[model samples]
Structures are given as structure tokens and as C-alpha cells.
Target chain A: AQSVTQPDIHITVSEGASLELRCNYSYGATPYLFWYVQSPGQGLQLLLKYFSGDTLVQGIKGFEAEFKRSQSSFNLRKPSVHWSDAAEYFCALTYLCYNNNDMRFGAGTRLTVKP
Target chain B: EAGVAQSPRYKIIEKRQSVAFWCNPISGHATLYWYQQILGQGPKLLIQFQNNGVVDDSQLPKDRFSAERLKGVDSTLKIQPAKLEDSAVYLCASSFGTDTQYFGPGTRLTVL
Candidate 1:
């Protein structure tokens, strides 16, 4: 079965510090990976996605993710963290089941930007 | 363009009671989905519909849970005799073909 893993449950970083969130996925074939952010009391917003082609994909809100096929990882990175950047991050992969595609999400990682 | 819309942003109901959530997908989106998200966890898909037909619902608890996307636009999910474990956020999303899905502000259900 296809699955996604987010090793970090919660992370605290100083404002303006660099940030990186780890994600690993298990799948047999090439997978469509995605990153989503959810703010408190709000719906989830797409950050980035990797379908094919270049390994690195840039997304909204100054977020970027690199899909490392060898490591089976798609980690998200931000050059500098801001107070507004704190939120829950989720890594997901498109999976095929019962002849239809559905998304499987990892346990989310909550980010705290300490000012 | 308008994003996905959901009603009853928050609801508190007693166990064994019935509750319902409504969702209106983005105009022209052919695919609609409903997901359940527990606190501190990621969203899990419960049901999916392609147009007016059911595409996938392998994870939905069929005994007391039911959903329908009639006419392929708006949808409703209902739970009868809700359980305590059903306390979570219910999210609705929609997509155009295989494109990125747009989510609505979820309905937070608390079963006491």
C-alpha cells in the first residue's frame, strides 16, 4: 500500500531562521507528491506539487520542495521563516485504488515560528 | 473564482445523534471529495465522486455514514448515531479532472 511519513510532529524555529520539514513516501510506481499547509481554523492550502520533470518545485508563500527519488523523500524548505509561516504541514501522494485515484496524507508536522 | 464552500462551520452534538454537512464544489469541477481530519493529524479521504457517480468510498464507514453528490455539483454527508470518535473536522474539496483540489473551510464536529 502507498503511504506517506512525516517524521517530525512539531518543530520550533526562530524567526528568520531556515526551515526544513522531512517527508518520506512508499510507493511502487512514480508518485504524484504534494505539500499542503493548514492554518488554525482555516482550510488547507496547496504549497507545492511534484508530478514529473524537475525534482525541485517552487510553491506559494515562499515554499519549495525537492523530490528525492533515491531517498523516497519529498522534503519542504523555506529560506527564512516568519511568524506567519507557523502552521501544520502535510505531505500527500496520489494513490491508485479500486481503479480510482485518491490522495494519502502523512501525519502532519506542526511548525512554530518563535519570535 | 470562488473556492469550495461548506456550511455549518461548527457543530456540537451528543453521541447517538445525527448530523449532516453540506458542500458546494467550485463551478465546473467534475470531481468532489469528502475527508475526515482528526486533531493533530492529516486529512483522510472518506468518499469521492466523479460527476454524479461514486468513484471511491472504500474508507467510509457505510453502516452509519452516507453521502451523495446529486446532480454532480453540491453534496451532503450524514452520520446517524454519531460516535465519539467521529469528532473531527469534515473537509470538502473539488478538482477539475486531475488538477489540484480546492478545499473549503471545514465543519468542525464535536460529539460529546
Candidate 2:
């Protein structure tokens, strides 16, 4: 079965510090990976996605993710964290199954920006 | 384009009661999805519909949970005899046939 794993349950970083959230996936073939952010009391918003081609993908809100096939990981990174950047992050993947697309999500990691 | 829309942002009901949630996907979106998000956890897929037809519902608890997408536009998810575990944020999302899904401001259900 295809599954996503987010190793970090919670991460705290100082404002303006760099951030990296780890994600790993178990799948047979290449999968469509995505990063999504959810703010408190709000719906999830798409940050980035990796379909094919380039391994590094840029997304909204100054977020970026690099998909490494060898490591079976898609890690999200941000150069400088701001107070508003604190939120829950989820890594997801979609693959074909039973003649239809099946999407799976990781547990999610909560980020806290400390000043 | 307008994002997905959900109604009754929050609801409080007692256990054994019934509750329903409404969702209107973005215009021209053919795929609609219903997810359940528990506190401190990621969202779980409950059901997926493609143009008024069920695409995937394996994860949905059919015994007490039901959903429908009428005319391939609007949808409703209902739970009968709600349990305390059912208290979570119900999110509705839509996409264009395997494309990126846009989510609505989920409906938070509180079962007392």
C-alpha cells in the first residue's frame, strides 16, 4: 500500500531561522507529491507539488520542496521563517490504484515560530 | 474562480444525534472529495466522487455515514447516531480530474 510519513510531529524555530520538514513515502513507482499548509481555524492551502522533471519545486508563501527519488523523501524548506509562517504542514502523494487515483496523506508536522 | 464553499462553519450536537454538512465545489470541478480531520492529525479521505458518481468510498464508514453529490456540483455528508469520535473538522475539496484540489473552510462538528 502507498503511504506517507512525516517524522516530525512538532518543530520550533526562531523567527528568521531556516526551516526543514522531513517527509518520506512508501510507494512502488514514482508518485505525485504535494505539500499543504493549514492555519488554525482555516482550510488547507496548497504549498507545492512535484509531478516530474525538476526535483526542486517552488510554492506559494516562500515555501519550497525537493523530491528525492533515491531517498523516497520530499522535504519542505524555507529560508527565513516569519511569525505568520507557523502552521501545520502535511505531505501527500497520489498514485493510480484500482483503476483510479488514490491520494494518501502523512500525519502532519506542526511548526512554531518563536521570537 | 471562487474556492470551495461549506456551510454551517461550526455545529454542536449530542451523541446519537444526526448531523449533515453541505459543500459546493468550484465551478467546472469534476472531482469532489470529503475528508475528516481530527484534532492534531491530518485529514483522512472519507469519500471521493467524480461527476455525481462514486469513485472511491472504501474509507467511508457506510454503516452510519452517507454522502451524495447531486448533479455533479453540490454534495452533502450525513452521519447518523453521531459518536464523540465523530467530532472533527469535515473538509470538502474539489479538483479537475486528478488535479490540485482546493479546499473549503471546513465545518467543525462537536459531538457532546
Best DockQ among the predictions, by candidate number: 1
Chain A TM-scores of each predicted structure, in the order given, are 0.96, 0.96
Q: After superposition, how far is residue B52 of candidate 1 from its true place, in Å?
A: 0.7
Reference-based lDDT, residue B28, model 2: 95
Per-residue lDDT for B27-102 in model 1, tens only? Answer: 9999999999999889999999999999999899999999998899999999998999999999999998767778
True contacts kept of 1: 0.74
Candidate 2 residues B1-78, lDDT tens each? 799999989999999999999999999999999999999888899999999999999999999999999889999999
Of the true interface contacts, each candidate retains a share of 0.74, 0.60
iRMSD, model 1, in Å: 1.5
Cα lDDT of model 2 by residue, A32-95, tens digit: 9999999999999999999999999999999999999999999999999999999999999998
Report iRMS values in order: 1.5, 1.5
Candidate 2 local lDDT, residue A28: 91
Instruction: Give candidate 1's TM-score.
Output: 0.98
Off by over 4 Å in 1: A96-99
